[model samples]
Target: MANITLFAQAIGRLPKECIRKIIREEKTDKHSKGYDTWSQFISMMFCQFSGCDSVRDISNGLNSANGNLNHLGICRAPSKSTVAYQNAKRDSGVFRRIFYALLAHFGQQAVWQRTRYRFKMPIKLLDSSTITLTMSLYEWAHYTTRKGGGEDAYIA
Candidate 1:
Protein backbone atom coordinates (compact mmCIF):
# COMPACT_ATOMS: atom_id res chain seq x y z
CA MET A 1 0.00 0.00 0.00
CA ALA A 2 1.05 3.62 -0.52
CA ASN A 3 0.83 4.36 3.19
CA ILE A 4 3.11 1.42 3.99
CA THR A 5 5.64 2.57 1.44
CA LEU A 6 5.70 6.07 2.89
CA PHE A 7 6.28 4.71 6.39
CA ALA A 8 9.03 2.44 5.08
CA GLN A 9 10.65 5.38 3.30
CA ALA A 10 10.63 7.37 6.49
CA ILE A 11 12.41 4.52 8.25
CA GLY A 12 14.95 4.22 5.44
CA ARG A 13 15.82 7.92 5.61
CA LEU A 14 18.87 8.85 7.61
CA PRO A 15 18.45 10.97 10.69
CA LYS A 16 19.32 14.62 10.11
CA GLU A 17 22.87 15.52 11.02
CA CYS A 18 21.49 18.55 12.84
CA ILE A 19 20.45 16.14 15.58
CA ARG A 20 24.09 15.10 16.01
CA LYS A 21 25.19 18.72 16.16
CA ILE A 22 22.71 19.60 18.88
CA ILE A 23 23.73 17.28 21.75
CA ARG A 24 26.37 18.93 23.91
CA GLU A 25 29.01 16.41 24.96
CA GLU A 26 30.84 17.19 28.14
CA LYS A 27 34.49 18.10 27.73
CA THR A 28 36.66 15.20 28.78
CA ASP A 29 39.37 15.92 31.31
CA LYS A 30 42.93 15.69 29.99
CA HIS A 31 43.62 12.52 31.99
CA SER A 32 40.71 10.58 30.59
CA LYS A 33 39.92 9.75 27.00
CA GLY A 34 36.56 8.17 26.22
CA TYR A 35 36.33 4.76 24.63
CA ASP A 36 33.96 3.80 21.83
CA THR A 37 34.69 6.89 19.74
CA TRP A 38 31.81 9.27 19.00
CA SER A 39 31.07 7.86 15.57
CA GLN A 40 31.01 4.27 16.84
CA PHE A 41 28.73 5.31 19.65
CA ILE A 42 26.37 7.06 17.27
CA SER A 43 26.27 4.12 14.87
CA MET A 44 25.48 1.71 17.68
CA MET A 45 22.72 3.96 18.94
CA PHE A 46 21.22 4.55 15.50
CA CYS A 47 20.97 0.81 15.09
CA GLN A 48 19.48 0.53 18.56
CA PHE A 49 16.43 2.78 18.04
CA SER A 50 15.91 1.15 14.70
CA GLY A 51 15.07 -1.96 16.82
CA CYS A 52 18.31 -3.89 16.67
CA ASP A 53 18.32 -5.61 20.06
CA SER A 54 21.91 -6.76 20.19
CA VAL A 55 25.27 -5.72 18.85
CA ARG A 56 25.46 -8.87 16.73
CA ASP A 57 22.10 -7.88 15.31
CA ILE A 58 23.49 -4.48 14.34
CA SER A 59 25.00 -5.81 11.12
CA ASN A 60 22.94 -8.97 10.91
CA GLY A 61 19.47 -9.59 9.44
CA LEU A 62 16.82 -6.96 8.60
CA ASN A 63 18.27 -4.07 10.58
CA SER A 64 21.84 -4.77 9.50
CA ALA A 65 23.59 -1.72 8.05
CA ASN A 66 27.07 -1.97 9.42
CA GLY A 67 28.52 -1.50 5.97
CA ASN A 68 26.30 1.47 5.32
CA LEU A 69 27.27 3.06 8.61
CA ASN A 70 30.93 2.34 8.03
CA HIS A 71 30.74 4.06 4.67
CA LEU A 72 29.69 7.22 6.49
CA GLY A 73 32.85 7.11 8.67
CA ILE A 74 31.30 5.73 11.81
CA CYS A 75 33.52 3.17 13.49
CA ARG A 76 33.69 -0.43 12.35
CA ALA A 77 30.71 -2.61 13.15
CA PRO A 78 31.88 -4.28 16.32
CA SER A 79 31.53 -7.90 17.36
CA LYS A 80 28.85 -8.65 19.94
CA SER A 81 31.33 -9.12 22.74
CA THR A 82 33.09 -5.91 21.81
CA VAL A 83 29.87 -3.98 22.03
CA ALA A 84 29.12 -5.51 25.43
CA TYR A 85 32.57 -4.77 26.79
CA GLN A 86 32.55 -1.14 25.67
CA ASN A 87 29.07 -0.57 26.95
CA ALA A 88 29.95 -1.93 30.34
CA LYS A 89 33.10 0.16 30.70
CA ARG A 90 31.93 3.42 29.18
CA ASP A 91 30.39 6.40 31.00
CA SER A 92 26.63 6.20 30.77
CA GLY A 93 26.30 9.98 30.54
CA VAL A 94 27.87 9.78 27.11
CA PHE A 95 25.01 7.55 26.06
CA ARG A 96 22.49 9.99 27.48
CA ARG A 97 23.77 12.59 25.06
CA ILE A 98 22.59 10.37 22.21
CA PHE A 99 19.16 10.14 23.82
CA TYR A 100 18.98 13.90 24.08
CA ALA A 101 19.80 14.14 20.40
CA LEU A 102 16.95 11.77 19.62
CA LEU A 103 14.51 13.83 21.64
CA ALA A 104 15.57 16.94 19.75
CA HIS A 105 15.08 15.12 16.46
CA PHE A 106 11.60 14.04 17.52
CA GLY A 107 10.77 17.62 18.52
CA GLN A 108 11.81 18.86 15.09
CA GLN A 109 9.62 16.23 13.45
CA ALA A 110 6.51 17.49 15.24
CA VAL A 111 4.55 19.65 12.85
CA TRP A 112 2.45 22.52 14.10
CA GLN A 113 0.11 23.46 11.31
CA ARG A 114 -2.07 26.55 11.45
CA THR A 115 -5.18 24.61 10.46
CA ARG A 116 -4.60 21.86 13.01
CA TYR A 117 -7.28 21.06 15.53
CA ARG A 118 -6.83 21.98 19.19
CA PHE A 119 -4.25 19.81 20.91
CA LYS A 120 -5.38 17.61 23.77
CA MET A 121 -3.44 16.71 26.88
CA PRO A 122 -0.59 14.38 26.09
CA ILE A 123 0.02 11.18 28.05
CA LYS A 124 2.81 10.71 30.56
CA LEU A 125 4.53 7.88 32.39
CA LEU A 126 4.58 7.69 36.16
CA ASP A 127 7.83 8.17 38.06
CA SER A 128 8.00 4.54 39.14
CA SER A 129 6.79 3.12 35.88
CA THR A 130 9.01 0.68 34.03
CA ILE A 131 10.56 2.22 30.97
CA THR A 132 12.36 0.51 28.11
CA LEU A 133 14.94 -2.03 29.25
CA THR A 134 17.60 -0.88 26.87
CA MET A 135 20.22 -0.64 29.61
CA SER A 136 22.73 -3.21 30.75
CA LEU A 137 21.42 -3.13 34.30
CA TYR A 138 23.40 -6.17 35.40
CA GLU A 139 26.37 -3.88 35.81
CA TRP A 140 24.37 -1.47 37.92
CA ALA A 141 22.82 -4.20 40.01
CA HIS A 142 26.01 -6.11 40.68
CA TYR A 143 28.27 -3.12 41.15
CA THR A 144 31.13 -5.64 41.05
CA THR A 145 33.60 -2.79 41.35
CA ARG A 146 31.72 0.51 40.95
CA LYS A 147 30.69 2.17 44.22
CA GLY A 148 27.10 1.79 45.38
CA GLY A 149 26.74 -1.37 43.36
CA GLY A 150 23.79 -3.58 44.27
CA GLU A 151 21.66 -0.52 44.99
CA ASP A 152 18.25 -1.83 43.96
CA ALA A 153 16.76 1.64 44.17
CA TYR A 154 18.86 3.09 41.36
CA ILE A 155 17.20 4.45 38.25
CA ALA A 156 18.08 2.99 34.85
Candidate 2:
Protein backbone atom coordinates (compact mmCIF):
# COMPACT_ATOMS: atom_id res chain seq x y z
CA MET A 1 0.00 0.00 0.00
CA ALA A 2 1.16 3.51 -0.71
CA ASN A 3 1.32 5.77 2.30
CA ILE A 4 -0.11 9.23 1.58
CA THR A 5 -0.89 12.12 3.87
CA LEU A 6 -4.23 13.91 3.79
CA PHE A 7 -2.35 17.07 2.88
CA ALA A 8 -1.03 15.34 -0.24
CA GLN A 9 -4.54 14.36 -1.23
CA ALA A 10 -5.70 17.95 -0.81
CA ILE A 11 -2.75 19.27 -2.77
CA GLY A 12 -3.38 16.71 -5.47
CA ARG A 13 -6.90 18.08 -5.96
CA LEU A 14 -5.52 21.48 -6.96
CA PRO A 15 -5.24 22.35 -10.68
CA LYS A 16 -1.49 21.80 -11.00
CA GLU A 17 -1.49 22.10 -14.78
CA CYS A 18 -3.18 25.48 -14.49
CA ILE A 19 -0.61 26.60 -11.93
CA ARG A 20 2.28 25.35 -14.07
CA LYS A 21 0.88 27.10 -17.13
CA ILE A 22 0.68 30.36 -15.22
CA ILE A 23 4.19 29.88 -13.82
CA ARG A 24 5.55 29.31 -17.34
CA GLU A 25 3.84 32.43 -18.65
CA GLU A 26 4.96 34.46 -15.63
CA LYS A 27 8.48 32.99 -15.50
CA THR A 28 8.13 32.52 -11.75
CA ASP A 29 10.80 29.86 -11.57
CA LYS A 30 13.45 31.74 -13.52
CA HIS A 31 15.57 32.63 -10.49
CA SER A 32 14.88 29.56 -8.43
CA LYS A 33 17.73 27.43 -7.04
CA GLY A 34 16.22 23.95 -6.69
CA TYR A 35 13.20 25.39 -4.87
CA ASP A 36 10.56 25.60 -7.60
CA THR A 37 7.27 27.48 -7.62
CA TRP A 38 5.38 24.29 -6.79
CA SER A 39 7.46 23.75 -3.66
CA GLN A 40 6.94 27.36 -2.62
CA PHE A 41 3.20 26.92 -3.03
CA ILE A 42 3.10 23.69 -1.00
CA SER A 43 5.13 25.33 1.75
CA MET A 44 2.75 28.28 1.94
CA MET A 45 -0.25 25.99 2.01
CA PHE A 46 1.32 23.98 4.83
CA CYS A 47 2.04 27.16 6.74
CA GLN A 48 -1.57 28.27 6.47
CA PHE A 49 -3.01 24.87 7.36
CA SER A 50 -0.59 24.31 10.22
CA GLY A 51 -1.02 27.82 11.62
CA CYS A 52 2.73 28.43 11.47
CA ASP A 53 3.68 31.89 12.70
CA SER A 54 7.23 32.01 11.29
CA VAL A 55 9.40 30.69 8.50
CA ARG A 56 11.26 28.53 11.00
CA ASP A 57 7.99 26.95 12.05
CA ILE A 58 7.14 26.03 8.45
CA SER A 59 10.58 24.56 7.80
CA ASN A 60 10.49 22.53 10.99
CA GLY A 61 6.94 21.37 10.37
CA LEU A 62 7.69 20.12 6.88
CA ASN A 63 10.88 18.44 7.98
CA SER A 64 8.99 16.65 10.72
CA ALA A 65 6.52 15.33 8.15
CA ASN A 66 9.35 12.89 7.28
CA GLY A 67 8.83 10.57 4.28
CA ASN A 68 5.52 12.25 3.47
CA LEU A 69 7.41 15.03 1.66
CA ASN A 70 7.63 12.97 -1.53
CA HIS A 71 3.87 12.45 -1.51
CA LEU A 72 3.49 16.23 -1.35
CA GLY A 73 5.69 16.49 -4.48
CA ILE A 74 8.62 18.01 -2.59
CA CYS A 75 11.88 16.05 -2.70
CA ARG A 76 12.83 17.49 0.66
CA ALA A 77 11.55 20.09 3.07
CA PRO A 78 13.14 23.48 2.46
CA SER A 79 15.54 25.04 4.95
CA LYS A 80 14.55 28.21 6.82
CA SER A 81 16.83 30.45 4.75
CA THR A 82 15.75 28.97 1.44
CA VAL A 83 12.03 29.27 2.27
CA ALA A 84 12.54 32.85 3.46
CA TYR A 85 14.60 33.80 0.43
CA GLN A 86 12.07 32.40 -2.03
CA ASN A 87 9.20 33.99 -0.13
CA ALA A 88 10.85 37.40 -0.25
CA LYS A 89 12.04 37.16 -3.86
CA ARG A 90 9.23 35.30 -5.63
CA ASP A 91 6.61 37.35 -7.49
CA SER A 92 3.32 37.26 -5.57
CA GLY A 93 1.46 37.83 -8.86
CA VAL A 94 2.12 34.24 -9.84
CA PHE A 95 0.13 33.03 -6.87
CA ARG A 96 -2.57 35.60 -7.55
CA ARG A 97 -2.90 34.41 -11.12
CA ILE A 98 -3.02 30.82 -9.90
CA PHE A 99 -5.82 31.74 -7.48
CA TYR A 100 -7.87 33.33 -10.24
CA ALA A 101 -7.23 30.39 -12.54
CA LEU A 102 -8.38 27.90 -9.94
CA LEU A 103 -11.33 30.06 -9.10
CA ALA A 104 -12.38 30.27 -12.73
CA HIS A 105 -11.87 26.53 -13.16
CA PHE A 106 -14.02 25.57 -10.17
CA GLY A 107 -16.42 28.51 -10.37
CA GLN A 108 -17.54 27.56 -13.87
CA GLN A 109 -18.92 24.28 -12.53
CA ALA A 110 -21.06 26.15 -10.00
CA VAL A 111 -22.23 28.62 -12.64
CA TRP A 112 -23.44 25.86 -14.92
CA GLN A 113 -25.41 24.00 -12.25
CA ARG A 114 -29.03 25.10 -12.03
CA THR A 115 -30.49 25.94 -8.65
CA ARG A 116 -34.06 25.22 -7.57
CA TYR A 117 -34.89 28.90 -7.25
CA ARG A 118 -34.03 31.66 -9.71
CA PHE A 119 -34.10 35.45 -9.45
CA LYS A 120 -34.52 38.01 -12.22
CA MET A 121 -31.68 40.09 -10.84
CA PRO A 122 -28.85 39.25 -8.50
CA ILE A 123 -29.59 39.88 -4.82
CA LYS A 124 -27.35 40.93 -1.97
CA LEU A 125 -28.08 40.87 1.73
CA LEU A 126 -26.11 42.84 4.28
CA ASP A 127 -26.29 42.32 8.02
CA SER A 128 -25.00 45.26 10.01
CA SER A 129 -25.05 45.73 13.75
CA THR A 130 -23.55 47.90 16.47
CA ILE A 131 -21.12 46.41 18.97
CA THR A 132 -21.16 47.55 22.58
CA LEU A 133 -18.05 48.75 24.32
CA THR A 134 -16.97 49.02 27.93
CA MET A 135 -18.08 51.97 30.10
CA SER A 136 -14.56 53.48 30.28
CA LEU A 137 -14.77 54.42 26.58
CA TYR A 138 -18.25 55.90 26.94
CA GLU A 139 -18.55 57.78 30.24
CA TRP A 140 -21.39 60.01 29.05
CA ALA A 141 -23.50 57.05 27.95
CA HIS A 142 -26.05 55.50 30.29
CA TYR A 143 -24.88 52.27 31.89
CA THR A 144 -26.85 49.61 33.71
CA THR A 145 -25.98 46.10 34.72
CA ARG A 146 -28.93 44.72 32.73
CA LYS A 147 -28.60 46.68 29.43
CA GLY A 148 -24.85 47.45 29.26
CA GLY A 149 -23.51 50.69 27.62
CA GLY A 150 -25.62 53.14 25.55
CA GLU A 151 -23.43 55.78 23.91
CA ASP A 152 -20.41 53.77 22.77
CA ALA A 153 -21.30 51.80 19.66
CA TYR A 154 -19.08 50.31 16.95
CA ILE A 155 -20.68 49.65 13.59
CA ALA A 156 -19.83 46.32 12.06
Candidate 3:
Protein backbone atom coordinates (compact mmCIF):
# COMPACT_ATOMS: atom_id res chain seq x y z
CA MET A 1 0.00 0.00 0.00
CA ALA A 2 1.16 3.50 -0.77
CA ASN A 3 0.73 6.43 1.57
CA ILE A 4 -0.99 9.50 0.18
CA THR A 5 -1.60 12.89 1.77
CA LEU A 6 -5.22 13.82 2.25
CA PHE A 7 -4.75 16.86 0.04
CA ALA A 8 -3.33 14.71 -2.74
CA GLN A 9 -6.16 12.22 -2.43
CA ALA A 10 -8.75 14.99 -2.54
CA ILE A 11 -7.40 16.87 -5.55
CA GLY A 12 -6.49 13.69 -7.37
CA ARG A 13 -10.15 13.30 -8.19
CA LEU A 14 -9.87 16.13 -10.75
CA PRO A 15 -8.96 15.13 -14.29
CA LYS A 16 -5.45 16.38 -14.96
CA GLU A 17 -5.92 16.43 -18.72
CA CYS A 18 -9.04 18.61 -18.43
CA ILE A 19 -7.23 21.01 -16.13
CA ARG A 20 -4.27 21.23 -18.51
CA LYS A 21 -6.62 21.92 -21.38
CA ILE A 22 -8.23 24.76 -19.44
CA ILE A 23 -4.80 26.14 -18.52
CA ARG A 24 -3.73 26.16 -22.16
CA GLU A 25 -6.97 27.70 -23.33
CA GLU A 26 -6.85 30.47 -20.74
CA LYS A 27 -3.11 31.11 -21.17
CA THR A 28 -3.08 32.16 -17.56
CA ASP A 29 0.51 31.11 -17.10
CA LYS A 30 1.74 33.02 -20.13
CA HIS A 31 4.78 35.30 -19.52
CA SER A 32 5.05 34.06 -15.96
CA LYS A 33 8.10 32.14 -14.78
CA GLY A 34 7.89 30.95 -11.18
CA TYR A 35 4.45 31.72 -9.84
CA ASP A 36 2.33 30.60 -12.75
CA THR A 37 -1.31 29.62 -13.03
CA TRP A 38 -0.73 26.21 -11.51
CA SER A 39 0.98 27.75 -8.52
CA GLN A 40 -1.86 30.21 -8.06
CA PHE A 41 -4.45 27.44 -8.30
CA ILE A 42 -2.62 25.26 -5.81
CA SER A 43 -2.20 28.17 -3.42
CA MET A 44 -5.89 29.02 -3.58
CA MET A 45 -6.81 25.37 -3.07
CA PHE A 46 -4.57 25.28 -0.01
CA CYS A 47 -6.20 28.40 1.34
CA GLN A 48 -9.65 26.93 0.78
CA PHE A 49 -8.81 23.59 2.39
CA SER A 50 -6.99 25.17 5.32
CA GLY A 51 -9.61 27.87 5.85
CA CYS A 52 -7.10 30.71 5.67
CA ASP A 53 -8.65 34.13 6.32
CA SER A 54 -6.00 36.16 4.47
CA VAL A 55 -3.00 35.94 2.15
CA ARG A 56 -0.61 36.13 5.09
CA ASP A 57 -2.27 33.12 6.66
CA ILE A 58 -2.01 31.15 3.40
CA SER A 59 1.69 32.02 3.06
CA ASN A 60 2.43 31.05 6.65
CA GLY A 61 0.49 27.82 6.33
CA LEU A 62 2.32 26.87 3.14
CA ASN A 63 5.64 27.84 4.69
CA SER A 64 4.97 25.54 7.60
CA ALA A 65 4.10 22.76 5.14
CA ASN A 66 7.38 23.24 3.26
CA GLY A 67 8.07 19.52 3.07
CA ASN A 68 4.75 18.92 1.32
CA LEU A 69 5.20 21.51 -1.39
CA ASN A 70 6.36 18.93 -3.90
CA HIS A 71 3.32 16.82 -3.23
CA LEU A 72 1.14 19.84 -3.99
CA GLY A 73 2.99 20.46 -7.32
CA ILE A 74 4.39 23.82 -6.22
CA CYS A 75 8.10 24.58 -5.89
CA ARG A 76 7.67 26.87 -2.92
CA ALA A 77 5.16 28.77 -0.85
CA PRO A 78 4.13 32.07 -2.40
CA SER A 79 4.65 35.36 -0.52
CA LYS A 80 1.65 37.18 0.93
CA SER A 81 2.14 40.04 -1.52
CA THR A 82 2.35 37.63 -4.44
CA VAL A 83 -0.88 35.93 -3.42
CA ALA A 84 -2.58 39.30 -2.96
CA TYR A 85 -1.34 40.55 -6.33
CA GLN A 86 -2.49 37.44 -8.17
CA ASN A 87 -5.86 37.49 -6.52
CA ALA A 88 -6.36 41.14 -7.42
CA LYS A 89 -4.98 40.95 -10.98
CA ARG A 90 -5.76 37.50 -12.31
CA ASP A 91 -8.80 37.06 -14.60
CA SER A 92 -11.61 35.39 -12.69
CA GLY A 93 -13.00 33.73 -15.83
CA VAL A 94 -10.26 31.13 -15.83
CA PHE A 95 -11.25 29.88 -12.42
CA ARG A 96 -14.92 30.09 -13.27
CA ARG A 97 -14.44 27.97 -16.38
CA ILE A 98 -12.39 25.47 -14.47
CA PHE A 99 -15.10 25.23 -11.81
CA TYR A 100 -17.86 24.58 -14.35
CA ALA A 101 -15.71 22.09 -16.18
CA LEU A 102 -15.03 20.15 -13.03
CA LEU A 103 -18.65 20.35 -12.03
CA ALA A 104 -19.72 18.92 -15.35
CA HIS A 105 -17.11 16.21 -15.12
CA PHE A 106 -18.15 15.10 -11.64
CA GLY A 107 -21.81 15.37 -12.42
CA GLN A 108 -21.33 12.40 -14.72
CA GLN A 109 -20.52 10.16 -11.81
CA ALA A 110 -22.96 7.45 -10.69
CA VAL A 111 -23.98 9.48 -7.67
CA TRP A 112 -25.41 12.23 -9.88
CA GLN A 113 -26.55 9.99 -12.72
CA ARG A 114 -29.87 9.29 -11.07
CA THR A 115 -30.58 12.93 -10.21
CA ARG A 116 -31.10 14.07 -13.78
CA TYR A 117 -34.13 16.23 -14.39
CA ARG A 118 -36.22 17.03 -17.47
CA PHE A 119 -34.99 20.64 -17.57
CA LYS A 120 -32.78 21.54 -20.48
CA MET A 121 -30.75 24.12 -18.55
CA PRO A 122 -29.57 24.29 -14.99
CA ILE A 123 -31.03 27.01 -12.77
CA LYS A 124 -28.72 28.68 -10.29
CA LEU A 125 -30.00 31.04 -7.62
CA LEU A 126 -27.79 33.92 -6.62
CA ASP A 127 -27.95 36.19 -3.59
CA SER A 128 -26.82 39.72 -4.51
CA SER A 129 -27.81 41.48 -1.30
CA THR A 130 -25.16 43.63 0.32
CA ILE A 131 -23.93 42.74 3.78
CA THR A 132 -25.94 44.45 6.48
CA LEU A 133 -24.18 46.47 9.17
CA THR A 134 -25.59 47.88 12.39
CA MET A 135 -25.21 51.62 12.78
CA SER A 136 -24.81 51.37 16.54
CA LEU A 137 -21.86 48.95 16.21
CA TYR A 138 -20.22 50.67 13.22
CA GLU A 139 -20.18 54.31 14.33
CA TRP A 140 -18.04 55.13 11.30
CA ALA A 141 -21.22 54.91 9.26
CA HIS A 142 -21.97 58.38 10.82
CA TYR A 143 -25.47 57.39 11.77
CA THR A 144 -27.61 60.06 13.32
CA THR A 145 -31.20 60.48 14.42
CA ARG A 146 -31.65 62.84 11.46
CA LYS A 147 -33.69 61.30 8.67
CA GLY A 148 -32.42 60.66 5.09
CA GLY A 149 -28.77 60.94 6.16
CA GLY A 150 -27.52 57.56 7.44
CA GLU A 151 -29.59 55.34 5.16
CA ASP A 152 -27.09 55.50 2.32
CA ALA A 153 -24.02 54.87 4.47
CA TYR A 154 -22.20 51.57 3.77
CA ILE A 155 -18.99 50.03 5.03
CA ALA A 156 -17.49 49.44 1.65
Candidate 4:
Protein backbone atom coordinates (compact mmCIF):
# COMPACT_ATOMS: atom_id res chain seq x y z
CA MET A 1 0.00 0.00 0.00
CA ALA A 2 1.01 3.66 -0.33
CA ASN A 3 2.91 4.87 2.70
CA ILE A 4 1.42 7.87 4.57
CA THR A 5 2.50 7.27 8.16
CA LEU A 6 5.35 9.76 7.93
CA PHE A 7 3.14 12.46 6.48
CA ALA A 8 0.58 11.85 9.19
CA GLN A 9 3.32 12.10 11.76
CA ALA A 10 4.38 15.46 10.36
CA ILE A 11 0.84 16.76 10.64
CA GLY A 12 0.67 15.33 14.17
CA ARG A 13 3.54 17.63 15.15
CA LEU A 14 1.07 20.49 15.67
CA PRO A 15 1.35 21.44 19.35
CA LYS A 16 -0.34 18.90 21.61
CA GLU A 17 -1.54 21.59 24.01
CA CYS A 18 -3.31 23.47 21.23
CA ILE A 19 -5.09 20.34 20.07
CA ARG A 20 -6.06 19.43 23.63
CA LYS A 21 -7.48 22.88 24.35
CA ILE A 22 -9.52 22.93 21.14
CA ILE A 23 -10.94 19.52 21.90
CA ARG A 24 -11.46 20.29 25.57
CA GLU A 25 -13.24 23.62 25.34
CA GLU A 26 -15.01 22.97 22.07
CA LYS A 27 -15.82 19.30 22.71
CA THR A 28 -18.15 17.55 25.07
CA ASP A 29 -17.82 14.54 27.32
CA LYS A 30 -17.10 11.38 25.35
CA HIS A 31 -17.92 8.67 27.88
CA SER A 32 -21.46 9.85 28.46
CA LYS A 33 -24.26 7.36 28.78
CA GLY A 34 -26.96 9.07 26.74
CA TYR A 35 -25.33 10.28 23.52
CA ASP A 36 -22.21 10.50 21.40
CA THR A 37 -21.01 14.05 21.02
CA TRP A 38 -17.64 15.62 20.25
CA SER A 39 -15.40 12.60 20.73
CA GLN A 40 -16.29 10.88 17.50
CA PHE A 41 -16.92 14.16 15.67
CA ILE A 42 -13.67 15.83 16.64
CA SER A 43 -11.52 13.37 14.73
CA MET A 44 -13.16 14.32 11.46
CA MET A 45 -12.65 18.02 12.19
CA PHE A 46 -9.10 17.32 13.26
CA CYS A 47 -8.57 15.63 9.93
CA GLN A 48 -9.94 18.75 8.23
CA PHE A 49 -7.87 21.19 10.35
CA SER A 50 -4.97 19.02 9.24
CA GLY A 51 -6.28 19.59 5.68
CA CYS A 52 -8.29 16.44 4.88
CA ASP A 53 -11.02 17.63 2.50
CA SER A 54 -13.67 14.96 2.78
CA VAL A 55 -14.78 12.29 5.22
CA ARG A 56 -14.09 9.64 2.59
CA ASP A 57 -10.56 10.94 2.09
CA ILE A 58 -10.03 11.30 5.85
CA SER A 59 -11.33 7.78 6.37
CA ASN A 60 -9.00 6.42 3.72
CA GLY A 61 -6.08 8.49 5.02
CA LEU A 62 -6.56 7.52 8.66
CA ASN A 63 -7.34 3.90 7.92
CA SER A 64 -3.89 3.65 6.36
CA ALA A 65 -1.82 5.86 8.66
CA ASN A 66 -0.80 5.16 12.27
CA GLY A 67 0.66 6.91 15.37
CA ASN A 68 -0.63 10.38 14.42
CA LEU A 69 -4.34 10.15 15.22
CA ASN A 70 -3.76 7.65 17.99
CA HIS A 71 -1.46 10.16 19.61
CA LEU A 72 -4.36 12.61 19.58
CA GLY A 73 -6.46 10.06 21.54
CA ILE A 74 -8.28 8.60 18.59
CA CYS A 75 -7.71 5.11 19.96
CA ARG A 76 -9.49 3.49 17.06
CA ALA A 77 -9.43 5.21 13.72
CA PRO A 78 -12.95 4.63 12.48
CA SER A 79 -13.76 3.07 9.13
CA LYS A 80 -16.19 4.77 6.77
CA SER A 81 -19.00 2.47 7.89
CA THR A 82 -18.32 3.24 11.55
CA VAL A 83 -18.25 6.97 10.86
CA ALA A 84 -21.48 6.75 8.91
CA TYR A 85 -23.09 4.85 11.74
CA GLN A 86 -21.87 7.38 14.30
CA ASN A 87 -23.11 10.27 12.21
CA ALA A 88 -26.47 8.61 11.80
CA LYS A 89 -26.79 7.89 15.51
CA ARG A 90 -25.73 11.24 16.90
CA ASP A 91 -27.81 14.38 17.47
CA SER A 92 -27.28 16.59 14.44
CA GLY A 93 -27.67 19.63 16.70
CA VAL A 94 -24.10 19.10 17.83
CA PHE A 95 -22.86 19.55 14.30
CA ARG A 96 -24.99 22.63 13.83
CA ARG A 97 -23.72 24.13 17.05
CA ILE A 98 -20.13 23.59 16.03
CA PHE A 99 -20.69 25.03 12.60
CA TYR A 100 -22.32 28.22 13.87
CA ALA A 101 -19.75 28.63 16.56
CA LEU A 102 -16.92 28.39 14.06
CA LEU A 103 -18.55 30.89 11.71
CA ALA A 104 -19.34 33.35 14.51
CA HIS A 105 -15.88 33.18 16.02
CA PHE A 106 -14.21 33.77 12.69
CA GLY A 107 -16.61 36.56 11.89
CA GLN A 108 -15.95 38.32 15.18
CA GLN A 109 -12.22 37.90 14.77
CA ALA A 110 -12.38 39.42 11.31
CA VAL A 111 -14.20 42.47 12.69
CA TRP A 112 -12.06 42.93 15.80
CA GLN A 113 -8.68 42.37 14.17
CA ARG A 114 -9.56 44.74 11.34
CA THR A 115 -7.72 42.47 8.93
CA ARG A 116 -10.45 43.46 6.48
CA TYR A 117 -7.78 43.86 3.89
CA ARG A 118 -6.90 40.19 4.15
CA PHE A 119 -10.54 39.18 4.38
CA LYS A 120 -11.70 41.45 1.56
CA MET A 121 -14.02 39.98 -1.02
CA PRO A 122 -12.14 38.65 -3.98
CA ILE A 123 -12.39 40.54 -7.27
CA LYS A 124 -12.34 38.72 -10.57
CA LEU A 125 -11.32 40.48 -13.79
CA LEU A 126 -12.32 38.41 -16.81
CA ASP A 127 -11.31 40.71 -19.64
CA SER A 128 -11.58 40.20 -23.39
CA SER A 129 -7.80 40.56 -23.55
CA THR A 130 -7.29 36.92 -22.53
CA ILE A 131 -10.03 35.69 -24.95
CA THR A 132 -8.76 34.35 -28.26
CA LEU A 133 -10.56 33.67 -31.54
CA THR A 134 -8.61 30.42 -32.12
CA MET A 135 -10.78 28.39 -29.68
CA SER A 136 -14.00 29.86 -31.07
CA LEU A 137 -13.07 29.09 -34.67
CA TYR A 138 -11.82 25.60 -33.76
CA GLU A 139 -15.06 24.73 -31.92
CA TRP A 140 -17.31 26.15 -34.70
CA ALA A 141 -15.32 24.34 -37.43
CA HIS A 142 -14.84 20.98 -35.67
CA TYR A 143 -18.15 20.74 -33.83
CA THR A 144 -20.55 21.98 -36.53
CA THR A 145 -19.77 19.07 -38.85
CA ARG A 146 -22.87 16.96 -39.49
CA LYS A 147 -22.63 13.42 -38.10
CA GLY A 148 -25.15 10.58 -37.61
CA GLY A 149 -27.58 12.34 -40.03
CA GLY A 150 -27.00 15.67 -38.19
CA GLU A 151 -28.34 14.40 -34.86
CA ASP A 152 -24.84 14.73 -33.33
CA ALA A 153 -24.58 18.28 -34.61
CA TYR A 154 -27.90 19.16 -32.96
CA ILE A 155 -26.69 17.54 -29.68
CA ALA A 156 -23.47 19.61 -29.81
- What's the number of clashes in each of the models? 0, 0, 0, 0
Model 2, 138: alpha-carbon shift in Å? 20
lDDT of 2 by residue, 31-83 (tens): 78788999999999999888999999999999999678887778999999999
Best by TM-score: 2
Q: Per-residue error at 105 for model 4, in Å?
A: 1.6
* RMSD vs true structure, all candidates: 14.7, 7.5, 10.6, 9.8
Better model by TM-score, 2 or 4?
2
RMSD of 3: 10.6
Model 4: weakest 10-residue lDDT segment is 147-156
Question: Which candidate do you rate higher for lDDT, 2 or 4?
Answer: 2
The candidates, ranked best first by TM-score, are 2, 3, 4, 1
Candidate 1 ranges with C-alpha deviation above 4 Å: 1-24, 27-35, 59-66, 113-156
lDDT of 2: 0.84
Clashing pairs for model 3 are none
> What is the alpha-carbon lDDT of model 1 when measured against the actual structure?
0.50
Estimated TM-score for each candidate: 0.42, 0.67, 0.67, 0.47
Which is the leading candidate under lDDT?
2
Q: Is candidate 1 or candidate 3 better by lDDT?
A: 3
Report the C-alpha displacement of residue 15, candidate 3, in angstroms.
Answer: 1.1
